[model samples]
Target: MAKEKKYESELLITRIFSAPRELVWKAWTEPERVMRWWGPKYFTSPICKIDFRVGGSYHFCMQSPEGEDFWSTGVYLEIIPLEKIVCTDSFADENGNVVPATYYDMEEDFPLELELTITFEDHNGNTKMVLQHIGIPEGITQELTKQGWNESFDKLAEILE
Candidate 1:
C-alpha cells in the first residue's frame, strides 16, 4: 500500500498603512470601502455584499481589465472590531456558491477551502495589518497570489493616503 502525501502551505503578509486602525477595519468590513481596493491594479470590484458579523458571509466579484470576472465568497468565523477577523475563504461562482479553485481553471492542487486571518494593530496613529492565508499550494501560484495581494494593498494604500 502506498501512502498519499499531504500538501499544505500558508502565505503571510504584513503591511503598515498610514491610516487609523478603525479606518483600515472599515475598509475590510464595509462593502463600499472594500470595492475601492479588493482586487489588483486595474481590477474593479463590481459587486461587494458583506454581512459584517460572526457567522455572516460576504460575496465579491472582481472584474479584470480585460472583462474577466473572478468571484469569491467567505464566511466570517470570528470578528473583533479594529483588531482582527478570521474567516473561511473559497472560490465561488457568480451566485456565491462555493467552488474549487480549479473551477476558475487554476492549478488542481489548490485547496477547495482556505482560511484567512487578518489582524490590525495601532502603529503610531497608523494601522499595521497582517494577513495570514492558509491552505495554498506552494510555488508559482503562491507567488502570483502574493503579487496580486501586494497590488491590492498598494491600491488600498493609495486610498488611505
Candidate 2:
C-alpha cells in the first residue's frame, strides 16, 4: 500500500499589488470594495457586511455563475490599522452562524473554523501583502482554496489598475 503524503496544514501566499498600502487596506475593510473581488473568477460577491474592528464580525455571500450561494462568516481577532488583520474564518449560513464545511457538502475533514492572518507592507509605492490561512484540509482542498484566492487577487488587481 502506498502511504499518503503528508501535507502542511496551512496555506500561505504573498503578492504585491500596484497600489498603496492604505488603498489595499481599504479594499479589505470596505464592504463595497470587497464585494468587487471577494471570490474566485466568475464568482460574484453579491452581499458583503463588514464590521472592521477587533472582536467584530463580517459576513459575505459569494454567488457562483450558476447562482449557488456560498456564505462565509468570520470574527475579527486583531486589527492593526493599515497593516495586519487576524480573523477566524468559517463556512456559514445566511444568518452568519458558523458551520462545518460538510454543511456546504464539502469534505468532512475541512475544519469548522480556520485562522486567517493578512499583513500589508509598503513596497516601493505599492502594497505587498502576505496571507496565511491555517487549518486548510491537507490535500486537494488546500490547492483549490489557493487557486480561488489567486483568482480573487487577480480580480482585485484589475480593479486597482
Candidate 3:
C-alpha cells in the first residue's frame, strides 16, 4: 500500500480592474460573463449553470482547444451581492457528480475539493478583486497549481477587457 500524503496550503490572488465594481461583480455573478473567461486561454466554457443565491449550485464544462473536456461544480455556501462569494469547488462528471481532482499530475493525496472565497471591492472606479483558494496540496505540487490559477486569471482579465 502507498503511504498517505498530508499536504495543505492556501493561495491569495488580488487584482485591480479599471471598471465599476457593479460591472466587475456582474462578470462573476452572471453565468454568461463567467463562461466568457473562466478557464485557461486555450480552454472555453461552453456550458455554465449558475444560481446566484446561497445554497445554490453552479455547474460548468470547460473544453480544451484540443477537444478535451473538464467539468466543474460547486455549491454556494455564502453570497453577498457584488461583494463576496464563498463556495466549494470540485471536479465533476458530466452529470455533475463530484470526483477526485488531479492536481499537477498527482495521482493521490490531493484534496477532492477546495474552499474558495472571492471578494469584490469598489475603489473609486476600479474594482479590487481578491480570490482566496484554500485546501491546496503541499510540496512542489502547490506551485504548479498556483501557476495554473494565475494563467486562468490572466484569461479572466482578457475576458473582462
RMSD per prediction, one decimal? Answer: 2.8, 4.2, 3.5
lDDT of 2 by residue, 10-92 (tens): 89999999998988999999999999999999999999999998999999999999999999999999999999999989899
Model 3: worst 10 consecutive residues (lDDT sum): 1-10
- What's the lDDT for all of these models? 0.90, 0.91, 0.80
Per-residue lDDT of model 1, residues 112-134, tens digit only: 77888999999988899999988
**Candidate 3 positional error at 67, Å:** 1.0
Candidate with better TM-score, 2 vs 3: 2
**Shift in Å, residue 80, candidate 1:** 1.1
Residue 111 lDDT, candidate 1, scale 0-100: 73
For model 2, what is the alpha-carbon lDDT of residue 32?
A: 99
Q: Candidates 1 and 2: which is better by lDDT?
A: 2
Question: Which wins on lDDT, candidate 2 or candidate 3?
Answer: 2
TM-score to native of every candidate shown: 0.94, 0.94, 0.87
What is the per-residue lDDT of model 3 for residues 92-118, given as tens digits with 9 covering 90 to 100?
A: 888888877663244576678788899
lDDT of 2 at 133: 89
